[model samples]
Structure formats: structure tokens, C-alpha cells
Target chain A: MSTIIPFGPQHPVLPEPLHLKITLKDEIVTDAIPMLGYVHRGLETLVSIKDLDQMVQVVERVCGICSCIHAHTYCMCVEGILGIEIPKRAEFLRIIWSELHRMHSHLLWLGLLADAFGMESLFMHCWRIRERVMDVMEATAGNRVIISINKVGGVRRDLSPDQLRWIAQVLDELERELDAIKPVLTNDYTVKKRTVGVGVLTKEQAYELGAVGPTLRGSGVAQDVRMTGYGAYKFIDFEPVVEKDGDSYARTMVRFRELYQAIDIVRQLIRKLPDGELSVKVKAAKPEGEIVCRSEQPRGELLYYVKGNGSKFLERVRIRTPTFANVPPLLAMLPGIEMADVPVVALSIDPCISCTER
Target chain B: MGFFTKLLETSRVKSPWIVHFDCGSCNGCDIEILACLTPIYDVERFGILNIGNPKHADILIVSGTVNHRNAKVLRNVYDQMPEPRAVIAIGACGTSGGIFREAYNVVGGVDKVIPVDVYVPGCPAKPEAIIDGVVLALGKLKEQRTAKDTDSLAAELHQAREFYANRADRQVVE
Candidate 1:
């Protein structure tokens, strides 16, 4: 007889509430089913009440870790409808801030992953490095997690020469600090034992199940939304980090390698910093079309679909967060593993339930 | 107070185990709560521990707006905590539902479901403010230790339930 267990809605391993009903037989899992809507606040319906400009703030709150990308995507959707091209400098600044957000978000995930595996000291060290990125965000954007710097036409905040110089210095310090902890995550005996060959999602399964971000790349797929050249990424030189193993270890390595990629992208953006106005004034013209915009978030691909009827309030606002797409892949990976390995495999997708539910 | 009671009170004040519940928060405030435990903030210096089990918890830290579904779970977790416990509602959503207040599913705030001892307000309450909120909740925990008794505890539960009932009625009227 198989024993059924409810994994969450309030489990310690999860930072957000995501319930998974796992069927187990003698410590081995038979299947896993996810139950969502715990963090749902009907944010999509708020588009009816909150105008386009105000929706930016609401969009940012959809998931705090990827707030910048959410706002950036929403703004991109609105800009697409309005048919306005943002300034080149604004594009570079947005990329800088977005990349910083990505770095901090991945660090947060890495620390959580460490804690899940009971590596307390490694968790602390990862968070310690993440705090540096948080400091830069707070100093530059005046808020740590949800910066709210993106506007429709361009960015609201501009970095001064001194601030830019300070950011570069911080980046240098971050690189040295990350190098110190990199080995423990990649080659440590305990880490490899817990993560290696666990929760493997084959490349074909990942593609069919619609896995995004590190989950897809970890399965040896070279798909990254950043490569689409939406914003300043077109000018930056980078590749999506991929690993063939498609296990928990591969997912961890994908995020770990992406940290350096984010830093490199930020460095390139700073070097190619163009001189221009921060924003073009958006007139009181109503957005009159439907547009879908996609951007890469720390978790994975973030898509925003906004519909407007020549009014201040959007008719419909639909968001497809990365975590939502990753759940099916998670369900696919859970069977045939011991119950103890559930947390390691579940967290491998960097499950952001709030983003998924919203 | 007897020796055992005095010892228990002292230990409770010295080391408070916190159980965090995320209601319907967008995750901004939830991360801030997590950040408090990190090295920079290092809330462990205050003898605070974040635990998963509610029964083992001395204080309940709730983030996000209390929505229709999570309000029941939030109350269940709050009820599971031992008596003389305190609740710290962090972030604007926890305190007053914040940006999602107008959203249909939101039940307004944490206080709508359970009594809150401290309210730390921010869009996503900063880590420093969350730490300060925990410190403030510790004081309330101490006060509850001194003031609470079996009869009064029962009375307070009734009052809390009645308070929620009345608020629900008022919301219906509005």
C-alpha cells in the first residue's frame, strides 16, 4: 500500500506556501500533485481599478524577488502598445538594475538551497555575499528588494558617474567573494552526494513540460529569453549556462554559473553607458492595443499580456510567471525518488509560489 | 510568581522561537523577514530562531495580506501556538493589506483573522524595521507572561472572536 503525504502549504523547506501531495511506498515516491492558490490575491483583476501607471507598482509586488523584471515587462508591454521607443541610456540602466536583481535573487535561491540540504555555514556565506548586492540596490535605487525604478517610456532613476564607479567597485568585491564559495557549491562531497543524479528532468521532458530558466537549461537546452535581444541584452555578450545532467546538481550549477554571467552583463552595460535623457515624457494618450512582452527573470521567463481599450485602465492583465511553467516539470521529476529528496528536487526549480499564484 | 513560572518566563523572553506564515503576500515582505536572519542583520543575536512547526513556536511572524483561503490557515497556525504568545504582523499588507487591499480575495490584514501585538509597516518592511518589530513583540510577550491567566485567557479568546465577528459585520455593512 502506498502512503500519501501532504508536503506543504506551510512546510519549512518552502519559503512560500506550495502544497504537494506525494504518494510514497516504502520511502520511495509514486507521484506528486501540486496544489496552488495559497498566495493568490486576485492581482490580475486589479487592472480594472488601477490605471496603467499605477499597475507598474502592482506588477512589481507580484513577486518581490523578480519585481524589477515584472515591472520592466509590464512597461515593455505598455510601450509596445503606445508605439514609443525608450532612450538607449534608459535601456542600459534598466538592464543594469535588472541584472543586479537577477544576481541577488539567484543568491537568495542558492542560500535557500544550501539551507535545504542542511549546509548551515554555506547558507550563511551565500547570504553574506548576497547582502553586498542588496546594499548596492538600496544605495542606487533607494529600496532593496522592490526598487520600482522602471517607468513606461524610460527609467525613473539615473546613476551618476560616482555611483556608477561605486557599483563597479562593488562588483569587483562580489566577484572575489563568490570565487571563495564557488568550490563548496560545485565540488563539495556532501553537496554532490545530495544533489547529483537526483530529480533528473531529461531534455525532451523539459521541452514538453515547458520548463523555463535554469530548469530548462539544466536539462541541456540552450533556450534563454535574454537571447531574443529585447532590451540592452542585444548589445551585451553572454550565453545561457547549460548543463547536461538535468539533476538537482545541474540546476544548482546553472544558477551558480549565471551569477558570473549577470555580473559580466552589468559590467558590459556600465562600460557601454550611453549619455541621454533618462525618460521621455509620456503624454496622457491612452494605450489602445493588446501586447505581450517577455523578459527573463531570476526564476525563468516572465511574460505579461496587457489589453487596453483606449482607456487609462487596462482591460485585462495576464501574467505567466516562470514558476508556473516549472511546476509541470517538477511533477514530472518527483516520482521514483526517496521522500527525503523531495525538498532538494522541489527547490531545484527555485519555486516562487507567490509568482506562480499571482 | 513561583520558581518554575519565573524560569519559564525568563527563558521565553531570552529565546523566542518564531514561526512565519505567509498569507497572500506578493513576497516582498516575506523576503525581508528572511533577510533578517541573514548575516548582515543576524537576528540570531537577539536569540530569535525561525522554526517551521507552529506548536514549537513562541511568536508568530505573519507577512502579506490575509486572503480568503490563507486566513483560515493563518488562524490555525496562530491557535496552535502556546498561550502567552505574541504575533508580529510585518509589512504594509500584514498591517493593512497594502497594495492588494482592493483585491477581491484579500481579507484586509492579519488582524482581521488574529490579534496582532506589533505592526511593522513598509511596502516590504525593511529588515531593520522587521528586527525592531520582533524586539517590540518580545516586550508584549513578556507582558502577556505577567498578565495572562486561565480565566483571562478564555475571556481574551472570546473578545478576539467577537472582535473579528464585529469587524466582519462592519465590512458587510460597508
Candidate 2:
């Protein structure tokens, strides 16, 4: 005989409200089903009321952790519709800010993942390193989390030479700090015990279920949206980070390795910083076509579909967030695991419920 | 006040255990709330804990706008907490629904479902600002404690009167 249990809407383990109905035979889970829409605000429907220019701010709030990428992708979509080629310097600036956002976002996830398995000290240490990233964002872009730096044509703010130098110095410090925690996060006995071989989604399963970001990369799939030469990415040397193990530990390592990759990308972009206008003046231009743009968020792939009908207001705005894509793989990984391991395995995908529901 | 009451009041101010509920926020404010617990802000120094259980919580720290579905869940959480509790609504969404006020499913601010004692206003309120809001909520919690003590006494007297009146009616029937 099997028993059914409801896990969350409000659970201590979950940061956001995601209810999962689990069918358990004794201590082992047999089936799991996710119920969403708790945090749904119908953000896509707001395009009717908010104009194209104003939608930048609206889209930024879609997911706070990857807010920069949302606005970056949205602006790219609008720019595509308008056929506007932003300045070289503006593209590099977007890269720098978005990479910083990636670093901070990865660190935040690492901390939460540690917290999931009851490693309180590790959680604290991970967040402590993340504060420096937030400090750099505030110093350069003004706000901490939701920095509205991206406009349709280009970026809104320019980093001064002094600020760029200071960021380089801070990145050096952050690199050193991250190195200190590397051994504990990767090689520690307890961390490995909890995460290793916990939620194994093979390459085939990941591909079939549409897993994106680290979830797919962890399963030995060498797929990343950044592989497509978009924006300033064409000018830089980049590779998608991948691991052969299809388990929770591999996913953790994927994000941890991406932290270093983000730092390297930011440093390269800063050294090759071009001199040009920050943004081009668009003289009363209204987007007249449908355009779809995709970018790699901290979690995974973020796709934005924007439709304009020769008007200020966009006809339709649809966002496909990474967490939404990763949910199927999450449900697939849950069954056959012990009930106690549910939180660690569930969090392994780095489920951002707000992004999923939004 | 007795010695025990004084101790209770002092402990209430000394350590305010908080339960945070995300009512459809973009997570900017939620991260800021979590940042308060980290080393840099280290709100634990002030004896505050983000204990996720509502039953043990003395203060409810709510972030995000209340939506159609989660409004019931928010109210249920608030009801579970012991009396003489305080509620702090963080961010512009939690305060007045901010940019998403016009969204079809959004029910505006946290105050739409539960009584909010402190409102920390920001697109995503800073960790320092969230800490300040918690300090303010503690003050409100202390006042509520005193008010509850007096209110409980009046409730006890009314219960005694009702019991005696019921007994007198039974005697007349006999």
C-alpha cells in the first residue's frame, strides 16, 4: 500500500511556495507531482498596459536573481524588431554587468543548496562571498539586485576608468575568496555524501525532459545558449561548462565552475573595453515586427518572444524561464529516492518558483 | 507587572523569531531578507532568526504582493502565529503591489490579507532597510503584548458572568 503526502505551499525547506504531492511506499517516494501558480502575477499580460520603453523595468522584475539577463534579452528582442545595432562598447558593458549577475546568482544558489542539506556554516560562507559581487554591482550600476542598466538601443550607464580598475581589483579578491571555499564545496566528505549520486538524470532523460543550464550540463550534455554567438559573445572566447556525472554533485560543480568562468569573462571584457557611445538616440521609433531573443541566465536558457504592431505598446510578451524547463526533469528525479532526500534533490535543479510561475 | 511578565517582555524584545512568507514577490526583496542573516549584515547579532515555522514565530516578515491564490495561504500563516505578533511587509510589492498592482491575479499589498505593522518600501528593500523594519516591528510587538494582557483579563471576567447567568436560568427552570 502507498501513502500520499503534500509537501509545501509553505514549507521551511522551500524559499518559495511550490507544492508537491508525493506518493510514497514506506520511506521511498513512488511518484511526485508539482502544483504551480501560487506566485503567478500574470506578468506577461502587463504588456497591454506597459509601453515598450516601460516594459524594460517590468521585465526586470520577472526574476530578481537574473533580472539583468531578462532586461538584456528583452532589449535584444526589441532591438532586433527595430534593426538597431548597438555600439561595440555598449555590448561589452552589457556582458560585464550580466556576467557579474551570473557570478552573484551562482553563489546565491550554492549557499541555498548548502542550506538545503543542513550545512549552515557552508551556507553562511557562500553568501559572505556573494556580498562582494553585490557591492561591485551597487558601485557600478547603482542598485544591488534589480539594476536597470539596459535600454532598448544600448546601456544606460557607463563605467568610469577608476570604477573599472576598482572592479578588476575586487574580482581578484573575489577569486581568492572563492578559492578558499573550493575544497569544502567540492571535496568535503559530508557535502559529497549528501549530493553525490542523489538526483541522477542521464543525458537522454535531460534532453527528453528539456532540462536547461547546469541541470543539462551536469548530465554530460554539452549544450548552452551562450554557444550561439549573440551580442558581444562573438568577440570573446567562451566554452560551455560540462560535467560527465548526471547527479546532484555534478550540477553543484557545474555552477561552481561557472563562477570562475563568469569572473574570467568579465575580466576579458574589461581589458578589451571599447571606446564609443553608451547608447544611440532612437528618434520616436516603434517596433513593427515579431522577434524572439534568447540568452543564458544564471539558471539556464531564457527566451523572450515579443510582438509589436507598429505601436508603442507591445502586442504580446511571453517569457520562457529556465526553471520552468527544469521542472520536468525535477519531477523525473524525485521518484525512487527516500522522502528525507526530497529537499536536496528538489533543490538540485535550483528551482526558482517565482521565475517558473511568472 | 510581575517578575515573570517583565522577563517575558524583555525576552520578546531581545529575540524576535521571524517567519518569512513570499506572497508572489520577484525575489529581489526575498534575497535581501536572506542577506540580513549572512555574515555582513548578521542579524543574528541582534538575536533575530528567520525560523521558517509560523507557530514559533513572533514576527511575520512578508515579501511580495498578495495574489488571488496565495492570499488564503498568507492569512492562514498569520492566523497560525501566536497572539501579540507583528507583521512586516517588505518591498514596494508587499507595501502597495508596486508595478504589478494592475496584474490580473495580483491582490495588491500584504495588508489586503493581513494587518501589516511595518512597511519597508523599496523595489527590493536593502538588507539594512529590512533590519530597520524588523527593529520597528519589535516595538509594535511589545505594545501588542501589553494590550493582549489587558484584553485577556476582560475575556475571563465575561466568561465568569456567562457561567453564573446560565446556572441561574437552570435554577429557575427547576
Candidate 3:
């Protein structure tokens, strides 16, 4: 006999509140349907009430884990609308912060994945190394974690030459730790047993369903928005990391490789950082235009559609988060997996429910 | 080690498996709790496991300010956990709704729905503070089980209800 088990909106394995209505024939998931819209905060509606400055804070709150990315996108959108040219130095700083966040976010996800597999020691190790990045963020920015350093036109804070040297030192230290983590994460038999071929999303399926970040990269798609050269990315040369396996291990590899790329991007920004004002002073005024801005968040590609109507407040703001785009791919991969692997599969895309619902 | 000594060690330190419950938080403390599990603090060395199921869990680590919509769900989760379960309320929002206290929808704190054994206390508390709070909860668990009768579950629930009712005025200032 087959049973339908509802996993989430309230369940243990889910890191986020994802309602997976799984049709199980014994222990295998024959069919899985995901139901979302739980954390939806009507951010689009709220955007109408907030001014451009306040909107930065509001948008930053969109995804707590990925707030820096959201804020950066919002700033980019607003800057595009106002036709204000940000300083070259500010652009470099943005790239540095964004990549730092990416490294930490991916490492954080890796730790959670380790924890989920019952690898307690590895979980601890990943988290311990992540703190070094957090310390770098704290020292440069007033706040340690959130690092609310992004503002309109450019960054709110500047990284001094001394600070740049400290950041370089930290990344170098992190590279050593990441080297140690790689063998345990990739070559370990236990991690291999849990992850390899656990969740399989084909290349065609990934494209059809619009998977983003490492999820798409894992499935052999070479799509990354950083390739578009937005902000300081044009100055910092790098390549979008890709893997063709389309399995849980592939997703893991994509994240691991991206961490290295993030480090490389930061190092390039530090070496090429121009000396100038970090933020361009913008007089508060209404923008009379509609602009669509897209930036790559840690999870995937995020699109922000902002409609301005000659007012300080935006007429309408629509943010299509990476998780929202990845949902279709998440559901497509679930039908053929064992019920126990559901959480690991869901997390492979780094499901950010807060971003999706908001 | 003798069986009695091993049993005593386990009892004194009921290494609780925590399952994170977010009634709806700003995600501040959620990340901080994750930080606690990371390498720097490594809450797992203390035998704390952040599990998924409420049935197998010995502790409920709830983040975020509770809202009217999720209050019933929070109570349901608390009810699902096995006996001698402890609730560690992490973050200012989880403890007293933090900045969201003034919001019309927020229910103020997790303790409004369930009895919280320890409050970590931060805008989103630091990772170190989260570790300390869990350690405190483990100690409190010893106090909870050694003296209380199994029949006091209903009574304890009643006390929690009364506390929540009185806690209405204790809401954080906007």
C-alpha cells in the first residue's frame, strides 16, 4: 500500500518551511509535490511605502543569510535608474564584500550538509573555519555578521589598504582550511554514500525548471550572472564554476569550487582596489523610470523589477529570488529519490524559504 | 566505567537533540544558531544534536517572534516532543519579540506558546551566547526531571499559559 506523507510547512528534516507532499510506495518517493508561500511577507507591497534609503534597509532584510546580495542588487537598480556613476573603488569594495559573503554562505551550507549526514566532527570544522571570514567582515565593517555595508550608489564603508592586507591574510588562511575540508567533504566514504547520486537533476531538467547557483552548475549549465560584469566584476577577472554530474555530489562540488572562485574574486578586488570615495552622495529624489536589475545571489540568479513614478518611494518592487526560480527544479528532482534523502536534495539548491516567500 | 556511573553521567547531562523551529523570524538568530553549530563554537562537542523530528528531540530551539498564525503550530511541536524536553528560546525576538514586538501580528515570544527553559537574549544573540544558553538548558533539564512527577505535564502547561497571559505587558518597546 502507498502512503502520502506531508513533510513540512512543519517537519524536522527541512531547514526551511517547505511542504513536500510525498507519495511514498513504502520508503521510496514515487511522487513529490512542494507547497510554498508560507514566509511571504508582501515585500513588493511594502516597497511602495519606503523611500529609496529606507528601501535599502527593507530590501536588505529580504534574506537574512543573503542580505548583502539583495542590498547590492537594490543599490545597483537604484543607481541604474538615477544615472549616478559609482566610483571605481566602490565597485571593487562591493565585489570584495559580495564574494566574502558568498564564501561564508557556501561554507555555512556545507556545514549544515555535513551535520545532516551525522558527520558531527566535519560540521564543527566547517563552522570553525567560517568564523575567520566572519571576523574579516567584522573588522572591516562595524558589524561582524550582517555587515550592512552596502548603500545606494556605492558601499557605506571603505576598506583601507591595511584592511585589504588583513582580508588577504584571512582568505589565505581560509584557503588552507578549505583544502583540509575538501578531502573530508569529497573523498570521505560516508559523505560519498549519503551524497553521491542521491539527488539527480538532469541538464535538460535543470534548464527547463530554471535552477540557479550551484544547482544549475551541478547539472552542467554554464550560466552565472557575475559573468555579466555588473558592479566591479568587470575589473576582477574570473570564471563561473561548473560541474556536469547533476547529482548531490555535483551540487556539493559546485559550491566548493564557487568558494575558491569567491576567494579569487576577492583577492583580485584587493589587488586592484582603486583609492577613492566608497559611496557617491545621492540627494533624495524621486526617480521617474522603470528598470529591471538582476544580480547573482549566493543561492542563484535574483531578478529585481523596480517601477519608479517620480516619487521617493517606488511605485512597485518585484523581487524574483533565486530560491523561487529553483523551486521548479527542486520539485522535478524529488520524484525518483528515497524519502530519507528529501532534505539533502532540497538543501542541495540551498532552499531559502524566507527569500522565496518574501 | 560502571553502568551506574555511565547512567549518572547521561542523566546529569541529558545531551539534548535540538530541532530548530522558526514560527517566523527575521532570520537574524537563525544564522546565529547556525553559527553555534559551526567550527568556532561547535555546540556539537557538548553532544547537542540539531535534529529534525520533534518526537526524537530532547530540546526545541525556536527562533523568531511568534505570530498568531503559528502559535498553534508551536504548541503542537512542544506537545510532540518526548518527556523531559527543554525549550531554549534563542534571540530577542524569540525571547520577547525583539524589534517586532510592536507589530500587530507578532505574538511577542515563544514562551507565549510553550514554556521556555532558557533565553539566549540578543538582537540575535551571538554564537557563544547560544552555546551558553544550550548548556544552561541542559542543566535545567536535570532540575526539571529529578523532582517533577510525570502527572505535572498538565499543570506545567497551565503555568505556561498563565505566564504567557501575564507576559503580554512584558512586550518589548518599539
Superposed Cα deviation of residue A72, candidate 2 (Å): 0.3
- The positional error of residue B70 in candidate 1, measured at the CA in angstroms, is 1.2
Cα lDDT, model 3, residue B101: 59
The DockQ figures for the candidates are 0.64, 0.79, 0.24
Residue A293, model 2: lDDT of 91
Q: What is candidate 3's TM-score for chain A?
A: 0.97
Instruction: Name model 1 segments beyond 4 Å from true.
Output: B149-174
TM-score of chain A of each: 0.99, 0.99, 0.97
Lowest lDDT sum, 10 consecutive residues, model 3 chain B, at B98-107
Query: What is residue A269's positional error in candidate 3, in angstroms?
Result: 0.4
Clashing pairs in 1: none
Question: Who is ahead in TM-score, 1 or 2?
Answer: 2
Q: How well does each candidate superpose onto the true structure, as a TM-score?
A: 0.95, 0.96, 0.86
Error of 3 at A130 (Å): 1.3
lDDT of 2 by residue, A1-358 (tens): 9999998988887889989999999999999999888999998999999888889999999999999999999999999999999999999999999999999999999999899899999999999999999999998888999999999899999999999999999999999999999999878998999999898999999999999999999999998888897889888887999998889999999999999999999999999999999998877777898988999998899999989989888899999999999999999999999999999999889989899999
lDDT of 3 by residue, A1-358 (tens): 9999988877654555677789999888888887665454455676655688878876766677777888899888888899999999888888788888888888888887876777878877887888898888778886655677888878888877788888899889999999988888767998999899988999999998888888999999999998998988888777888999899999999999889988888888888888888777898767879899898988999999988898888888889999889988888888878888888888888888878876
The 10-residue segment of model 2 chain A with minimum total lDDT is: A280-289
Model 3, position B41, has a per-residue lDDT of 72
From the highest DockQ down, the ranking of the candidates is 2, 1, 3
Worst 10 residues of 3 chain A by lDDT: A35-44
Candidate number achieving the greatest TM-score relative to the actual structure: 2
Which of the two candidates, 2 or 3, achieves a greater lDDT against the reference? Answer: 2
